[model samples]
Target: MTDWLSASAMLLAGVIVGAMFLYGMRRRQDRSDLERADLEAKRDALIARLREAPDPSLERDAAEVLRKLDKMGVEAAPLGGAAGGLKPAATQIKGFLWGAGSVAAIAAIVFFVTRQTKPAAPADPLADLERSVQQNPDNLPLRDDLAKAYLDRNNIEGVSEQTQYVLQRNPSDARALTYSAIVHIIARQPEAAAAMLQRATQSDPNLVDAWVGVAWLNAQAGDMPRAEAAMAEAKRRHPEMAERLDQLMAHLRGPSKAEAVHVTLNYGGQARGMIFIIARAAGVTSGPPAAVKRLPLSTFPIDVDLSAADSMMGQPLPQKMRIEARIDSDGDPLTHDPKDPGAVAEGVVLGNSVSLTLK
Candidate 1:
């Protein structure tokens, strides 16, 4: 009876031990599942954050989270075969991303260094002139030089500013007045130019160029008597120009003709230096001109009669001719370089003031 009691108690104790072992195993499994789910949720959250990350700071944080996930994956190696296999792949992906980040950092450094080593562009000549002018505003010679430079470049606004400044300092300045007259001529205001030229001569009577310009304008206006008087004055002021004055006189007294070609010159745009006007028979590209006149660019919008006296030879003038006006950059009447800007009027008739544009 005592042996039977012992066996029954041993069986009861075995049953209780077996039941406790099963419950502990189930509890451990539930904890493992909870840990895996938590790790997966953390990885998903890190991936989402990485997708919206704007800068390197968030990228680093995401990388760190990936490393932790990778470590957790290794720690949960016994959970399943799939979990164990994910460890190496996750480590490789992390290494690739780190390499890419390092490369990007290196590229940024190279780009910045290259930019720092590049050379700057050269300074502009006009800018240098402007700076010098600003530094010495009262220098009249410098101002005039700057004004001339502006005129050469056809910069009307710049020319006006510099010339106006010089004029303000000395209103009776002959040179400034002449330059202003030139500007007026370029602007196609002949009356204003003539006034300025007149003022320039009045301020200084001995100004030979001014006197010559006056004579030329008068001749253009068909006031031959006034032109001759102005020419005499120019010769008196500078006797060395007597021969030139004689040649101009001869041109003014052109050979008599039943009908002479009349030309009215008009400037379509900006013009400077000298102008060479020629009348050639239509289709005659070479040989001496039928009539020719060389005048300063300032004498534009002027009417001139072309007759046999303007002819290079003593022969009669052609009936049918084309008139050409060339802006001579070098002031050489003998040259008609194709590069020089010019204009031509075809089918021109004698005894008629045919208007033409010097482009």
Candidate 2:
């Protein structure tokens, strides 16, 4: 409350100063206008009196009036008198605009500097989730969200702790099963991971992660039919996973003989971001990719591979396609940021290796 009052007081003082300065400038201009009018009136009266009486002193007075009026920058008829009498008038200022910038600068400095500079506490992104879990300890969804958040941050211990908590309470929790399966996989216990994933899929058939895990396990076992079935089911259930399924399928199928694509980037010390190696139908630039591969953000001179497994909707690419290598600034493929370094190669063949330079 005290800080607020001090800030308000400073703001009010600045406004009053600005108002006074403007009012003073206006009053000065009004005084100049009034003085010019008074001088012009005296000059006219002197001229009329001199014409009637033929007075020499009044003629001199008329000339003096003209001089004073001229000095004030108001033009009027000159008196017929001596030429070499007074010094030249000083140069007049156009307006008070010259002082405006300085006054505004000072005001801005005060306006910025007067406020308290409180040091902001660094934000914890998962604070809300943590608090929610703390308040509702029995909420499984909150615990799941907190677990995912921890997993994203690579807090492995936190992930283990949360998943254990949930599974201990409800062993058949689908999401918790998926999280445990992932933990098993990371621990190099593939059999245990497979069992957990299978249970997760049985518990929740709509769990995309369980379906993906099943597909990956089968594909690695060379059971292409089961893998393809799992993928087909996932695509039918959740179409948004098509891009990822394609990429996963392509990678599991291994590199093709005639359809392999190798893209080399000649990146010259630019911003590091996720690389999107997208293949579009020939002459097409809009919409999703015919085939795409995403590489991790890394240093310059990165190599990328794109093949049929990366194709959307389990489709094969045409003989020729437009291959675009883009370093997505925000990792979003749909939106393009102009700052993202990119290169395009037209009419690239399926088996060809293309070299691109990012700018």
TM-score, per-candidate, Cα-based: 0.35, 0.42
Cα lDDT of model 1 by residue, 248-292, tens digit: 666655545445777777875775667777888877876546667
For model 2 the TM-score comes to 0.42
TM-score of 1: 0.35
Write candidate 2's Cα lDDT for 207-231 as tens digits. Answer: 8877776776665455889888887
The 10-residue segment with the lowest total lDDT in model 1: 72-81
Question: Best candidate per TM-score, number?
Answer: 2
Task: Say what the RMSD of model 1 is.
Answer: 26.3
Off by over 4 Å in 2: 1-125, 255-359
- Candidate 2: RMSD over Cα atoms? 16.7
Evaluated at residue 74, the lDDT of candidate 2 is 62
Query: What's the true lDDT of residue 318 in model 1?
Result: 77
